[model samples]
Target: MTETFPASRLWRDIPDLLFPRQCEGCGVDLAGNGTLFCWDCLAALPYLKPPFCARCGDFVAGDVPGDFVCASCARRAPAFDLARSAFRFDGALAEAVRRLKYRAGVWIAPGLGAFLAETWRAVPEALRGRVDFVTPVPLAPERSRERGYNQAGLLAGALARRLRLPCRGVLRRTRGTKTQTKLSAQERRQNVRGAFAVRAPYRAGNRLWSRWFPPVEGKRILLVDDVITTGATVDECARALKAAGAEAVYALSVARGNG
Candidate 1:
């Protein structure tokens, strides 16, 4: 008699066996490559390095005295206390983000999360221990329904798992806002204002999280997102967190728009 495997098990293994593993960035079969990114393509991604702006983590082209903010950030202050980005939103990184956000490439989260964890190691140590909780900027219920899932939430969940930190849905979108695309910088900022609110005294897991985080009053939060354009969305979320007595809020993203 020949041994037989369960039908379900065989079906489950088919995709992995036949498709093999491919580099997420380049779509090349990564069999024995031992990486989700091809060497050349990985080198091409715009990985942000140090000597970046102290406030927004944007690359600073010219030397500036002291811990200075970027020209754009200095001209118009970002609402979040601090911001860090893993990659510049261009080239292969941008394409990967678009695929993940718009094309249902949800499987890309783990790779992106790993990149974020590696990038985050360069963050100032003072801020690392201060982070008490992790929250992703929420999408409006209607938009989330249309998209089937919030990309930011997926990234946040993966990041939280890697960081061994608690992740929660604390901010809720109160209104549907216009897409930021094709909007002026000022208009984009105005559009997202007052669009988000924190659920009062955030509750999760059937328990009251009254004193779970302690820095300002309740918690110091690290907000995660797939990408940040004008920092408007994150700013609004930060305002809500602060209003709810969060000590400090830091925004981190996989990519940044045009900076």
Candidate 2:
């Protein structure tokens, strides 16, 4: 008897054998591995654990007996009902997010979106059940033209596929704003206020509207993004969504940073 391998299998394996996929974090050869991250890198991920804020997902250092909202959230509650993230914005996760956002590394979106999907499963069913659709935080027209893609949109599409939910681009940036990296939390909030608007779906004489641009009115939405720093962008987005008649909006992101 002679051993046999399928032609399709051989064809698929040849490329991997010739030039194995490399780990995105450490550049380790992944000849047969299916995932993007190696075991060590995945294990070292800075996962956000308990004792985080109830409203926003900021990591709290010390132990707390009961529910707590961060100072920023308490000062002025965000428009979104809740926000959560998969990991703290540090270590390799931070680097991955930066690469996706600034370096046009869209390849990493699916992996990061998987993290968001896993984190979403831990959300209470009461809230998760209410989510009727998923949408991304929109990028400005200028930035989208320069980047050629919206990283948040990529993440949202990946997540929606995993969760079997409809993904739509329902919001648009009203205008371009300065980068929020250097701004204080207060300034960040002010900068993005009124910066987003919901795009009204065209009802007549459009075939794509029913499939791709369904009305969000009276529907619950899940907003996906690459990271949540000050919660300003998502809050503004939520405000616009609600103003457009969305019943509820909950936010999820790959990483969260202390604001």
Candidate 3:
């Protein structure tokens, strides 16, 4: 559903205030340069540097050579081959994302997407070239109806545009699950299980699914989201994509939350 948010529309002319102009990385007044963040916030935006887990993209403290997997990943690998994010979800970053998710902070999308683009550019050549389509984690119809906009969808659109790829909604939530926010890591994993399915063609003479986007079979799909807390949601999404014949599925998020 198109979010005709009264607040968003009311302050359309005042772009700075339409969706918060303060720096999400830090509570500072924006420079009014359309960036919505101060230079300091931009510098401190916490890019997830290397020596991390090759599987789940978590930060590894010590020097762990090439393709190293953290102990957590070694125990159990996520469904997606690789998952990455631009920042660790803590302090200002967490607050920033919360604003975007709960509040109508769509303005943060471009900045977040650009970070994902940079991460993608740094991926291995072989893996990078395999990405054929970009998609977002599907929100349940009920939650989407309540929020009037999906934060992941908004992030996917911006990130795909930055990566010069088309954004496609190729997955759909099959069931409504409890919010993963307050759940423990194990609870999170269980909560999202079997919650998603690969979206099929809508066959009512509608171009909603099949006609608009190509089939998922044999394609390298990049799944986008606002955050990766437990790897439960995106893992399920990747499972669905793989079941639908996608050769590989990668997950990207704006931030990563430590459990």
Best by lDDT: 2
lDDT, candidate 1, 64-128, per-residue tens: 66676788888877667788899889988898888678766566776788887776667878745
Ranking the candidates on TM-score from highest down gives 2, 3, 1
The alpha-carbon RMSD values of the candidates against the true structure, listed in the order shown, are 7.1, 8.1, 3.3
Q: Write the per-residue lDDT of candidate 2 for residues 167-242, one digit (tens) a residue.
A: 9999998899988888997899899989998886777888787568778789899998888998889999999999
lDDT for each residue of candidate 3 in 1-259, tens digit (9 for 90 to 100) = 2334565453673565444556676667765555646788777666678887888888867777787877877898777989888888866666667766776666776766777888877888865556787998988898787676888998899888987888888888889999787899889878988889877745566666565556788989899988898788888899888888888899998888752
Candidate 1 overall lDDT versus native: 0.76
Candidate 3 — worst ten consecutive residues by lDDT sum? Answer: 1-10
Which candidate order results from sorting by lDDT in descending order? 2, 3, 1
Clashing residue pairs found in predicted model 1: 213-218, 216-247
Off by over 4 Å in 3: 1-14, 17-22, 25-31, 202-208
Please tell me which model should have the higher lDDT, number 1 or number 3.
Answer: 3
Compared with the true structure, all predictions reach lDDT values of: 0.76, 0.84, 0.79
TM per candidate: 0.83, 0.89, 0.87
